[model samples]
Structures are given as C-alpha cells and as structure tokens.
Target chain A: MPMNPSLLDNPKSDRIRRVADLANAKARRRSGRVLVEGPQSVREAVAHVPDAVSDLYVLSESEGADTEERSPTLAAIVDRAEQCDSIYIHRASEAVMHRISPNAQGIAAVVDMGALTSEESQVAWSDTPTIAAFWQVRDPGNAGAVIRAADAAGCDAVIFVDDCVDRFNPKVVRSTAGSLFHIPVLTMGADEMLAWCSAHGIAVVAADIYGTPGNAPRTLPDMLADRVAVGQSKAVLFGNEARGLPRQLLERVDRIVTIPIYGKAESLNLATSAAVMLFSLAMSSHMGRM
Target chain B: MPMNPSLLDNPKSDRIRRVADLANAKARRRSGRVLVEGPQSVREAVAHVPDAVSDLYVLSESEGADTEERSPTLAAIVDRAEQCDSIYIHRASEAVMHRISPNAQGIAAVVDMGALTSEESQVAWSDTPTIAAFWQVRDPGNAGAVIRAADAAGCDAVIFVDDCVDRFNPKVVRSTAGSLFHIPVLTMGADEMLAWCSAHGIAVVAADIYGTPGNAPRTLPDMLADRVAVGQSKAVLFGNEARGLPRQLLERVDRIVTIPIYGKAESLNLATSAAVMLFSLAMSSHMGRM
Candidate 1:
C-alpha cells in the first residue's frame, strides 16, 4: 500500500514549500547531503539508499491527479527510503517550479550526494580511472552531460577546474538525469588542480579542439597510445570551445591533445567530445595493451 | 549604419514569416535558406555575412526587461538583414512566437544554413564508404547530435531506420547547431537498410548496451577486429535504448557489438554511446590499424 497522501496535503504540512537554493546545495556538501531532482531521479536515489534522502517534493494539487506517473507510486518509493519521510509541497504550482528551476519536469528531492571529494579520495580507483576535467567549460548542460558520460565510461570521477560551469546548478542537475548523484565531481582553480595531478603522479593531458596546444605526443591517439601511467591516476582536461585552455594552464599539464575532426562543422559539442575521450580511456583500460 | 527602425517595426513583411515550419525550412534548405535562432546565434549568423540572411524576428517588446543583453543591437541586426532583402517580423506578439516556438530565446532568423548542400550531394556509392545507421533512436536531439558526431567522424552519410525520431524536428535541428545541414540524413525501413548494407558490401555492426543482439562479438573493438572482410564498407547500427533490436533484425547484420562499460551505471546516453563507437572507428581509420 502507498503512504497516506492526505497526511502530506494537510495545511500543517510545511515541508513542501521549501525553496532549494545554492546554499541548500552547498549545505549538502558539508553535511553529506546531495540534492536529487525530479521524480525518476528521486526514486533512483531512494533505491541507491544514498545517505538518507531528506525530503520529496510533490504537487499537493496534482496529488489528486491519479496515475502511476505521479503520486501514490512515488509516495511508496519515498516510503521505501531509509526513513518513511516524504512530503508534498501543497503549493508546487507548475509556474512556481518553472520559476524556481530551469525546467522542473515534475518532482525534486534532497539525498546524500555521496562520498567522493577529491581525485585521490578513492583508494581503489577503477583499473581505468577515466577522468574528464572541464577547464573553463561554461555550459551547464554540457557539464552535466559530461558527468553522465563519466558515469557511463565507468570513470572514477568527473572534475572541474578554473572557470567551468557550476556543477551544483539546477540546470546542470536536470541535464545529468541523476548521474550527479552517482559520480564524484571535484572542482578547483588551476594551481590546485595542477598540484593534485603532480602529487598523485597522474598523467594530465590537455584536449584542445584547435590543435596548437602541444603535449608529450602528437595527437589524442598518440597520448592514448601507451600513455597510461598504470598504477597511477590519469586525468584529461577539456577546455573552452572557442579558445581551449589558457597557455599557462596547458603548459602545467603533462601533454596536449585533440580529437581529429574531418569536416568544416567547426567543432564538436563539448558533451560529445567528453564522451569520445572517456570512451577512449575506457577502451584503453579494458584492453590493457597500451 | 543600421537600417531604419520603422522598417523593422512593420510586421507586414512577407519574407519575415517564411521560417515557421519544415516546408519553409525545406524551402530554405533548397534555396540556400538558413535559419538562425536566439540573440547569440543570430548575431554570429549576421556577422558572417555579406552573403545575405533570409528573414529575421526581433521582439521589440522584449520580455524580461534586460536593457543590456537584449537591446538596440538586436534592432540593428534586424535592420541590416532587412537591407539584404531579408524581411522582418516586428514586436512579435507574445502569442505569435510563443506559438511558433517556445524556445526562441527572444530572436530568430532564416539565414542560409551554410554552403555546399546546393552544390552537389555527398551520397557515396563506392564499395567501402563509411556510414552510420540509427536503428530506433527516439530522441530528435540525440538523433541530430549523432549526425553532428558523424560529421566530425568523417562518415559519408547517416541512415535512419525503423522507428526513428523526426529528423526535421526543431529540437534536433537546434541541437546539431546547424551540423544537420552538413550531413546527408537518409530515412529507410528495416529491410531497405539491410539491403543497402548488403549491396554496399558494408559490414553492418550492430551496437547494443547490454550485449550484441545474438552473438557476433562482445564489444565494438572486438567486432571491428573480427569483421574478416577487410577494406569493406562498414555501417554501424544502434538500436533502441529500452528494448534494443529484435533477434530477426540482429541476425541479418554481419556483426553485433557492445561498448565496454565499467560502472554499475547501466548505460550511456544514446548519443554518447553512438559517439564512442563512431570516434573509435575513425581512430582505426586514421591509424590504419584497427
């Protein structure tokens, strides 16, 4: 049976009207809280049993609209959480959601974002710790999708450095489709990111679409060709679509690389570029043959 | 100097309204018509031309009262396009553009999409031309983005087969960021696709997230390695994310493949998955060593 709906819709139910802001998302970082947005993601978060989802936001008015798509089933999923705590905001008007979110497909939630803090935070990283670093990438959707690709590539983490989009932004949240809850996202300025790379002994490669940024080898494949510093962490940095990386930032890294584009299409989308690089790393790791 | 403001204020401009549908997009497609949307894209589209834009939309009664972001510069852009025989849609009633497009981002235009579609077709009839085939992709955005990836990967053409999304869909057109105009997108049925593959002597490699439909090879790299028929054309078929390809369809293909995924995360986003395989093929082609 589903959780009691009327209980959540009562006038006393104050939990439903809370605004989610950057402060809320940042608070999650401190208290191990991670915000999960929308209905499908809320359920997935519950299933993953991430650090106890703190709340569920459902439309009190739409609660009466009966369908498996909305209420009771969602309520049941919330009930199945580590705690039976789920609440519906009686005032969740579509306009309210639209105003508050880039696009609130419907529901949103707060869960434990999970235990990844830095690149080295994982003691036992994947055999192929494929890392995608956004260096000055400004698009929120592209940032979110890169995190999703990192998850798909089975990468240990997706990190951001100097001038990249905010990983916690709501638009990025919507684009990730819950991958944000699944992957480790790290952020820092160039000095700090470079410091981590040096200490960890990871091979840092720069991915520039314009091709002038030179690294240890010729091109992307040459870097992928026997570039794995096995038993050491590996990170590849992708930068601004038009300008790529700042010269100082590119120089601090181990190697510079680029995907060979064959047409006059100008440049590939950032997310598409991330997918290609992450997948290439995955293949190299899987084959284990440099 | 910018064109006259009164000319842009006139909504009766006939050439201003031609970009509202596929018939018009196709008309533009035939007569070197190009469509540009949003303030940024429009600005770039106009700056690139003495060639001439087709039409322009400027919301003189701009919403969101931002004086800096959307302003007289937009009016100036419209004025310039108008001088080039481009028509103008003025003070677009909130209802008109909203109905025509919910995502206008305040301005739009019909510009020449780009050069070359008018010159000659890119259809390849040789024995070993490379190609991409989308079996049942349902997202127009993903479909269009895959076309963009194919353009980057140097595939001769992208074929759509069985239950594909509408390629001409606006979301797809926008997602490709005009790369759709660069690639030849052909739609065909299941039988026709298989026949085309066979006739071209293309080794049709099917891609599924879980496993290849029946048993051709375990992963894409393996499939590429095992094709036996070297120097033959290759058509990579990607199936629906949900159900994948039916057994009968898989059996008709020369090979089946999976992307090597590491995370517990079940699958890659459809377009991301497609990009991985496509770039990997291009790598093989460039290296002259699969």
Candidate 2:
C-alpha cells in the first residue's frame, strides 16, 4: 500500500472528512457529488453514469495486484473514462482509498451529481420500453433493490418521486447489485412524470393494495393488456411500504393494480412490490409476442 | 403486566432458557417448533396454522394497550383464536413479553414446522396447479419477501427446497409484511421438487445468472424473457445473491430464466429476482383475461 506524497507531506485531511460525511443526504446533495467505495460498487458507479464521475482514485494495490495486469473490471472503468475525462488510476495507498470510501473494495470513484437521468426521457415510453417509478419510498435499500429489480424486469427506465431516498447513496448502490447502470433512473417532480405520461400516451398505473369499492380491478394483468394491444409501453408506480400510495395517485392512474394478498400479512416491501408489478408488465408484453 | 401463575411461580426458569435457544436452527428443529415474537406476528400465527401454534402467552397490560381490539389488522387473529382456548393473555407487564420475544408486540405465538401441500394444489407448467419453488435461499428476509411476492403473483404454492433458512424465522416473518397466510409454503429436498414437477407436468424454470456463456448479464430483463412464455405455467427457482441455484438443479430445469443485468453489479437480491420472474409468469396466464 503506497500513500500519495502530497497527502503524506501536507498532513491535510479535508478530503477524507468530506468523503466520510458523504453518507448523509444533505452532504451528498450539497456536494453535487456522491462517493462510490469498494471495487464492486466503484465498478457499478463507473458503468451506470461514467460521465457523472468527477474524479477517480485507485488504490495502488487495486491498480493491479503486484503480479498481474489491471483487473478487467478496473480496466473497463479506465475504458469508460474516455467519455467524461474524470477517470484517474493512481498510486494512492489502500489505506487512503479506504479513508475516502471506507469499506470500499480498495477503490473509490467520485461521481458528479447528474447521475439521475432526465425524467422527460422516461415518459416517452416506447411500445417496448419497460419503465418503473417509485414514490414516497423511505428506505434506501428498498429503493435500490427496486432499481435492480426494474433493470432485471427489463423496465426501460425508472423514476423516483417525493420522499424517496437519494439514489446515489452508498447503501442504494450496494443493494442494486449493479443494475443501477443499465437503466436510466430519473429523480424529478411527480407532475413531470404525469406530463411525460400524457405526452407519450402512456398510462400512469399506480399499484395499490386496496382498490375502490365495488369496482373490480383489472389485475396488473388487465392493465398490461392495454399495453400489449397497442404495443405501447407502461410505467408502474409504487409507494411507501407502510402507508402505500396516496389516494390521489391511486385514483389518477389508468387503473389500480394489486398483487393479491392471501396470508395474514397483507403487503410486501415497497421494492418487492415494484419488482412484481414490473415483471407482470414485461411478461404480459412477451406473452403478446408469443 | 400479568403473568400466568404456573409460568411465573416457575420452578421452570430452566425451561425458559431452553426455549430462548430455539432462535438457533438446531434447537428449533429438535424441538419441532420455532420461537416467535411480536404482536402482529403472533396474531398471524394464530390466524393461520393455529394448530401449529403450540403455545400462546400475553402480558396483561398488552390486552387493552395493544390496540388489538381496535386495529382491524389484528381482527383475523382474535377471530381465529377460539375463546375457550387457554391462551395466557397477561395485562400486568410488557417487559416479561420482551424477554420472550425481543420487540414483542404484546403477544407471542409458538408455531410448529411449516406444512407441505400436495402437487394437485400446486402451480405446475401444464394443466395443473402451478407453484414456484425457492431453493436454498440464504436470507430470511429474501425468503419472506418472496413468499409475499408469490402470493401477489397468484402462484398456487411456494416451496422451500434444500437447506434454506427457516420459513417461520422471525426475520422472515417480519419481511413478509403479513402475506404468510396467503401462500402455502412447503419445504422438501431438491429431489422432491424434481419429482413433484415431473408428476404435475410443471416446467421448472430456473433463474440463473450464468446458464449461458460469455455475457455476464447486468440486469434481470436480459434473461427474464425466457421465463414468460405463453401457454405454460411454470415453477421458478432462485438462489441467493452470492450463490445462484445449485448446478445440478439448474441443469435439470426444463428452461432457464434470466433477468438480464444492465448495471455494473453482478446480480439482484434473490427476492427481487423471484418477484420479477414469478409476476412475469402469473401475468402471462392472466393477461389474456384482461
């Protein structure tokens, strides 16, 4: 483990302090940056929004183990860096990298704040675009898990609405299992999502556990039928696990979609529900193809 | 809080010590019961599989202060517990209950091992009751979440095969958010699942990250397409985040399903992926109705 001469000589630790506080929402938002620690998370940070990367630091050991060439994942980061010019692989010691992104896999990447995609792009749901949106979700882990689920379910994009956790939060990156990169995740106004849906002629389906009285809900299956028929894309929005979606959103959507609850526990986690609904939409489309 | 005179007068303090150890699997299996805590959880225990609930206890103060009478969510439990049954509901203290179940919600229900449902009532790929089998998933949270998702997806049953976490584990029950009653979960050997699938005409679709070569999928959508074919009901199996499905089982599956990975991470949590695949399969059957 080699230490950078500049830091060793100066005895300055402002950089380390800032990175330590990166876990909090306020610091993350204010810095216009988010920190990625660990080889796995750093690799994903690189893949998802390389352009958002403002600075890159590689622990001397991570650059290449003493005996080998650069690791493939690391090399991929270097390759992706060409787009944004913020990539750096240097001889900072493992200890130093850990100081910046502690518990990181001996590697760290400083990403710019624009990691979230523009919500407008997501609203233009192509006939085949699978999109998922989350609202008022409190848990960063759940939010991250859902993003990974959306990417897995083949949702074209995902959007986050009010009170959801910060997307770039380290916990979120970890939970995504790296699917955060492939899909565009836009954090924007609810009205923006509504407008985008209107423009694209896509339906805004709110997934609610409780349906309006006396009206039989076309199950998520029924909701997907419209998408399958026109070959239009669909977006499903999920709310907080505890309170569920606001009644306003529930009523506003094309229709309420619910996964049946048969057991004593009536609901699933926010992220899990998102996965279920998104998968339903995706499968419905594929079934149409068949 | 109130205490049962027989339990409190306790020459049986040793008994409490032994039961507390049931948090460990070996103790639970040997005892043929799992220790459960929490008011809502206990309620769920009573509501579903009441006979499986071998013992019941409550702090007297918990009776009125617990809001069970007021919380509609607790109604099912009260209704399920026959009035004549000798459930010890004590009103004197909450502290004692905490000793029994940490963070106990005023009540506790001890449950027997999970039961197995027959193939005739399961989800099979052909003209049979279709069910999904989750195999050797390590996380109790993931297991619980999957059960909730399976319930939502309308899978007839959910089975836990091989040596996975216990279904009734407290963490699992908490993760389920109350759907434990809706789905019938069976635990059996890998060979048992294979035999069940063969007999029921169910096509087993195994979700694997690396069933094919070269491309490491970054998102589930990439591989999930195979899980959603029309005209077939399927039982899907998923493994943990670090380890995927067992190779022997993966090889034996009729079709391999994958949720394509688009991000930098290698995979999603088992529950998220299960939800994606299960919902996809359910919607495939239901979309035509829509």
lDDT of 2 by residue, A12-117 (tens): 3676667667778799888877777666766776666666766666655434335435567665665565455556444456566666656666566677766554
* Candidate 1 lDDT for residue A231: 30
Residue B286, candidate 2: how far off, in angstroms?
A: 5.2
Q: Which ten contiguous residues of candidate 2 chain B have the minimum total lDDT?
A: B1-10
DockQ of each: 0.46, 0.36
Residue-wise C-alpha lDDT for candidate 1, range B1-290, written one tens digit per residue? 23324324323444444555533546655655555566544664555543545556666463432342446757666656655544444445445555445676677766554532322155844335678888888876788788888877878888888878766566666666656656677878999988877776678877865443356556765644543433467888887756777778887787667887666565677788888888887776566553
- Candidate 2 residue B173 C-alpha distance from true site, Å: 3.6
Report lDDT (CA) for all predictions: 0.64, 0.63
Q: In order, what is each prediction's RMSD in angstroms?
A: 6.3, 5.5
Docking class of 2: acceptable
Index of the highest-lDDT prediction: 1
Q: Looking at every candidate separately, what fraction of the true A–B Cα contacts under 8 Å does it contain?
A: 0.58, 0.48
List model 1 lDDT by residue over A196-278, tens digit each: 76776667877775434344434556555554442346788888765777777766777666787875356777788888877
Instruction: Quote model 1's TM-score for chain B.
Output: 0.69
Q: In order, how many clashes per candidate?
A: 8, 47
